[model samples]
Target: MSGKGGDVRELLAQYVTNLEDDVFAIQNLQGVVGAVMARYSRAETGLRETLLREFVKEDKLKLAKAYKLIERVLIAYGDDSVGELEGAHLSFENISMLATKVIEHRRIGGSPIEQSTRYVRYDFKDPERGYHYYCPESLKDTPGEAVFRDRMDRMFANYGRMWQPLNQWLERHKPVEEAVYDLGDMGSTYADMADDKARKVFERTYRNDLKTKACDILRSFLPLATRANVGLFGNGRFFQHLISKMMTAPLAEASHLGRRAFEELTKVIPHYVKRARLLDYTAANERQMRRLVPRLVPELCRSGRDSGIQLLRPDFENMAGALAGDGPVSAQRLSEVWADEEECGFLASLLFTYVRAPFEVIRQRVRRMSREQRLEIYDTYYGERVTRRDRPERGIEFGYPYTFDLVTEWAVYKDLMRHRMGSIQFQALVPDMGFHMPGELEEAGLGDIARETVALAEELFAYLDAHHPTEREYAFLQGHKMRWLLGMNDRALMHMLELRTTPQGHPNYRRTSQKMHDLAVSLYPDRARRMNFVNHDPVFWSRSDSEARQRLKEQALEGDETAS
Candidate 1:
């Protein structure tokens, strides 16, 4: 191994050795390391195959079974939360040996994942590759009517020409019929083969010609998404990240496909996959509120007589020299500590950042609310507007608290502009921002619509390449519409949270609300203190409109039955 490879192995060793909490590593360490390892070793099929075979033989199991054992060993070893095992030294040696080979085989920043746009280039012309099943061409009557048919036909013909020679060459040495049968389909022929055989065949088959053909198709026809998944082995964590994004997203086909993938993966690795947790903010438990308040709003500690006030705690009912009771003090609101836009914005973004645990913590509070309590909380907290019509009943809406909805952000901004807020705060358009605002922007010229959204937040991905070039990273920025709600008070927030944190809520809203909750507690632990009317006190919040809620319940039941 070279000096740099040794350094990496050493770093990895220290990382595992120093991992503090095993439980913390339940998913994070194994996930990050596994992902990093996968990316780093992705191209090193030979090395990976060697390790897999050796590991499997040692574990005395089939490939899948051995893979699981290896995963278990790494997870247990990498996890600091597992406590010290009796055979820690022996296990470490084994893992270290594996890590060394992995590091030795690592490329750029260490990941061996390829970046060629060649072999799978033709895949871009495949509509199914984009995860969009309902192409306008698919429904057309004629076979040649599809936009990609001509290009695809040419690709197949070209590929056949290229592969024909190889097939003939193989036939000269072996059986011609078997060679002809073996190259059934260019890409998927190996799908039916064993991993070893597939690797060996593809290592030879994916020649310059194949890559050239792939690049030709990719550069011409494929969307970025279709070309992205080539030569990749996405681990559970990556899927978790992908699923989180797609869960509440609007792309019906992609989201459905992603969900199905998640379902299948969960079946294979049930212990590793975390099922989505449903949360409702308004119906949050007051007790948890009281407990979490200390962490959220420590300043509340000084608000009462027990806090430093001259409170009378008389032994007798009429004690002469007793401290005077300072009657109930108003709970300290989040604004006391976090009145600034920067702090609030930072928190808002954090909530939407989509880290799971913190997201779930806030989500649980939202999920506990009864249906009626949610709307009442909304009415009490939010300023009534036409956009209130968009709020989903019964389920938590995504993007609550921080911003009700991305659409709501635009609508609210438009309303503000109508009243002349535009002079002070004009909306800027972001170019090529079409993927996010699909339904809303579909009617607008795709390019023009993209131009309407301002690109205030550039992806921080460039930094990843600098510090860890070998690592794969993805990131996004909050638009101005969502960024402005940082300073919104508890009332505006309660309604937002109530709506967004439910299943019926928009997915982005749900994610955003959780982000806001996480930020609130993390940023200003002093002021955001008590069980407010809308947030913690679900009992009272729901009481405001019991009848309207009953009607909603009836309507929902009717709708459900009608759908059935």
Candidate 2:
């Protein structure tokens, strides 16, 4: 990521230079390699002397010596932290949506950016492959291959067929967007596109908005095998764990891609990821767990079906009695719910760092204690706090975790799952239950076509059930319905809701975020005070303005005087 005379270069950061088919590690930066940095910290020699002895140049090291040092200290001594010092960038192009989920599920140590369906058109066929979806390497040459190919071709064809009517209807329903012919002082965000150049961009943004809407509705007709690109950036430690996990994934594609990633990364950072292998114990344990995993009665799991969101953690009716002392389990539960918000907050903060007993037990004891005792505990614990960074302890985090069982659209679930602050799980993508009918799509008079697509999808999925069951998931459309369960603390919950409910958020997810906020607020009324940041208003032509602003900001950064 090297660039000249910009924020990146100003920071004195340098990137490894490379040519085609060439990838290499950073021998050193500022005369300190990752390998020597470890020894440099522990060495008796002075910094100046260490620099001269370790470096082949003022800011680099001899490649052979650096390799030897890393091999001896990192590989032989089994020092894993040394691997974390170096990072790498990896990108996967034209990967199936199903496979992208497995890689993007990592909660930490990596950041990824995937091409958004909101912005990109998925209707085109690859010139070489003849389709926009991935055909499994395993399914090739089998009887199912012809069936899979035929069905996918029909799915994308239906996707294309619906586009024309949807777009024409959108043009009629929402005509020309308001335009800004001039950018006077560059202070106004709304004045649509300010200057003439930006005006052209804003016009294009309006046109693309129609495309986005049509894509959203028709996306339901495309299958999960739709291919998109993703780029991931992480340290060696992150890749090591990811490589090991993917190598053991049940999907053959996952295992093959894992090997491919490891192979490419080895050329740049070899020793750091040397131990990323599929261990026998790990594979055997997974196999045993799969056998022991019990499937509860499906009907019970499907209770309260057809609804969008259901709060499961604080099932007040089922839990109110157990917690109110009428039953033997009154003094139990994970303290998912509390009687007094203030006291829960106080005790949760006071004895938060200690008190290793059950939370409900502690609350019962809190009822027996005096205010002075609680105050004394709190004061003793936090009295020495001198900065804002002395933030709240982890008790609130553990105390207020909430869970929801939601029947959300596949597209919304895809966006929401990218937020890994919570525990999220979903069932196999299936078309039987029901599907969403985007209002615009129905109004556009394409309702029959949408339903027909789902019917065809169900028919194909049924046939695959007999032939290739797992392969049937590739048949699920973006607007198809699936049940997802999510559990997270209040902080993470609020963050997800606020961010996803923005004016520019996809309508599918914005509605879901609003419902989540309403449910959570109704459950914990006190939380509503701080939850005012949630955006509930709709802004027509929102993305165009945002796009214009981003373009102008980039222009300003690039020293374009006309931008301002």
Candidate 3:
């Protein structure tokens, strides 16, 4: 075997040995070591060890037996006990049309890293010299196949055609050097470089930024059928729930993906995911909900409207007085205060666990303390927190609440929907709301073509809405507007604002985040003064490009080491 393959085998063996040791330790703790030994002896050590060795040699039995044992114990105690133990991490790749569904199913308890629309350019031709898309099997032999193909082809064609003009327009309109002052060290270094070299670097960055913006707008033209790679890392229990839901989904692609995922997952963690099957209860519930919706509110079911943002509850009264003092608080002071508050809660909860005092008395005593006294107590409790691991308790964040009503493009909504910590309630996905045209498209002189395409999509959406309302959403373009009600606390707001306002974020969502931040500051300027993480500067390259360049550099270093 090659050196690398042998090294990999060694690592695998070490991992398996450690896992087996952990299993044995747990069994001993549970006082089941004797029972486990008895079973192993009955199976005969020679045969059992031989089978295990063969499985290990094949590199397939990492924790299979341990998982099986855990599964058996859990089942014996009742399925409810399964929650006590987290299943093994199972990774999945090449998941496509099901990307949105899988990612948005945050209740399934998994983390998904999907191919970003901002970083990866999907407008290019595939290896097969055709656009990459997910064509439903049901449509393959039907008359609709021709329509689907033609529409997808034209969408990709327009996307490709707009590329050059969009880049050229961006070069003329949004120069990179103009925003160099905002990028700190990187910008200063670039600014100080030789003129010719700086220009070259600047041009590359400009083109990347331009492409991202153009793609953001152009992506609206691409249907949901466009394939996207998504990597999922989640436990078997969550996978079981996800697979069951997918199997019952109305989409043919979802059903196919669910079946394939289930089959593959069973190979690794068979016992834990054995219960993954389509439940008629869930399917019937979905059917009834869909059927009852239109019948109960027929007028609300109608489509066609303009999209925009509306801030519903900007409750600043509670904190307005507290923040009325001097200017915004310093970042250090803000962090100190937050840490202190969280420490107080942590101590209180800890005391509640052991104290003989009545809960109401304890609550009253804590509440009656002077603000200064409380701050001092908390400061002593949390001496120094230089790292995130020493940060404040999560409960402290519940003090700040924010609510917004947003009407943005469907493409932007998809990005925001991934922030599952927030409650995102949305209206129907329809083209009733006028779509957003890409500014680059207008600058590229493809404004007419873009408008025409949107018009065509709108007409088709109208037809679909009237005839097939349930499936009409598939016809809605990315630029189509949809309204959503967002309710989130300060912690969720921090994550959404900081993430969505990054230089690489979609402009539409970036604008939304900026608006949100602006609104928050306006209401509670003192409290939000230190919420300075929002990025308003421009970026030269997408994050994907940056990561790829880093990977190449690392590979070069490895090659040099190997040569030495």
Candidate 4:
């Protein structure tokens, strides 16, 4: 913005909120914009007055004058909160699904829009070999390169080959109109429309439904190597942590992406993201965790079998007085009930982040405190919140936590990971754990083909792992089973269960969501009573029905429903 005059002022006023525009990202001088704005908080004067009077510059902002302030506050004074004052929009295009998932999981506060396999056509397109997949640089020199290429080609080929047959099956079974017609159709305008026009709507919408279902089914065949897009908006602090996390990830793809992201962010938010480097603590901790977890937990060292959705509190409920004081009182709110038992754990949770004391200390203190004290803490923590979206408070890191051992397909894992409000631990997806065979596929007789593709990918994975240990995850079929632990608090669990168990969702995840909800309900019938949104109805061709409802809504909005 040359010489903060009329033109620059008008430009700033016009596009102040639209940070997604490149204009804000490139021209802000990164921290300079945030620094100038942050000054108004500490200053007694208005923004224009602060800029002109305090900075003592009427015409323009000098870099050293404003930039130095941010550097001092953030770097020298060691105030991390200052980093939250600025952020930027970043787009990751045509990256691997693995990379996108890792990014989403690691990211703190960001709205991420990912390329949906349900909506996007998975046709082979562009770049050298007419296939959309990420080939690791590590595989280029190895004999596994041939195996990788062949497996990817075969998967894509089958994905393309099955499209027509799948569509035909959808059309024949999920008919656009019910065969057992009602007399009400005689008065229905949509029913009276020329068969050709009806066919047009059916072809368009049902074709959309077809794309959604077919891709959802065959998406199991998609390897983690398949290229996907993700765009997110995050603050500088978020980027710093996320970048450091990726840099230390198990796969080199994550580290490479992190470096590239760091380089690009330098062009936009250089000062804010300067600390986005490999941290000694992060690398050392992760390396040791990987090395010693098996030794620390003897069960982890051995071959363990899949146990679908087992609630993971070992030697649980043996307490002679476990149920004592668990029953909800007449005056109790849902938030006050520490359903997990022992101490007013839920109430003490609100102080988890704010207090520097250890969580056990807080829990014990709460345990000794009177009922009124815990109630007061609960009210003080959450009562003044305006909306449910206010994120409760800082103490979500602790309090009333539930852990579930999940044996699910890679497809379900990707969907589940979207709820990043909890801690997660997952093992590698190998052929030994097996795949999730959807009933729809088994009924359609393509179940065998899907299994065959997993075997093909497994063979490639074995070949590649033998040659070198890198990029084995890239070979993992999305349907391959892996055991993962999802640890969430009550609110997070409710959100996941209510959302994923909806009829419009994929059947596989829907079932798991139902099971999670059922488990919660069985465990705490009183606390989870309000969780009636959990859909336990029979699901079949849900996309078809969902699309049909959408069509009716569109017709009503367009006034076509009133047509003669």
Best by lDDT: 4
lDDT of 2 by residue, 318-411 (tens): 3465467644553335253454433644463334223222223334555555767666544544445453423332233333456665777788
- Candidate 2 weakest ten by summed lDDT: 292-301
lDDT-better candidate, 2 vs 3: 2
lDDT of 4 by residue, 164-196 (tens): 777777767766564221112222333454677
Candidate 1, which segments miss by more than 4 Å at Cα?
1-115, 118-245, 274-341, 344-564
When 1 and 4 are scored with lDDT, the better candidate is: 4
- Per-residue lDDT over 249-328 for candidate 3, one digit per residue giving the tens place of the 0 to 100 score: 77656777778878887775565567777756545544544454344324434543453554443223423443457488
Q: What's the CA RMSD for each of the models?
A: 27.1, 11.3, 14.1, 9.8
List lDDT for all candidates, in order: 0.30, 0.65, 0.57, 0.67
Which ten residues in a row are the worst by lDDT in model 1? 86-95
CA shift at 286, candidate 4, in angstroms?
2.5
Clashes in model 2: which pairs?
Answer: 182-194, 183-194
Clashes of each: 43, 2, 3, 0
Q: Give candidate 2's whole-model lDDT.
A: 0.65
Task: Please give the lDDT score for candidate 3.
Answer: 0.57
By summed lDDT, the worst window of 10 consecutive residues in model 3 runs over: 25-34
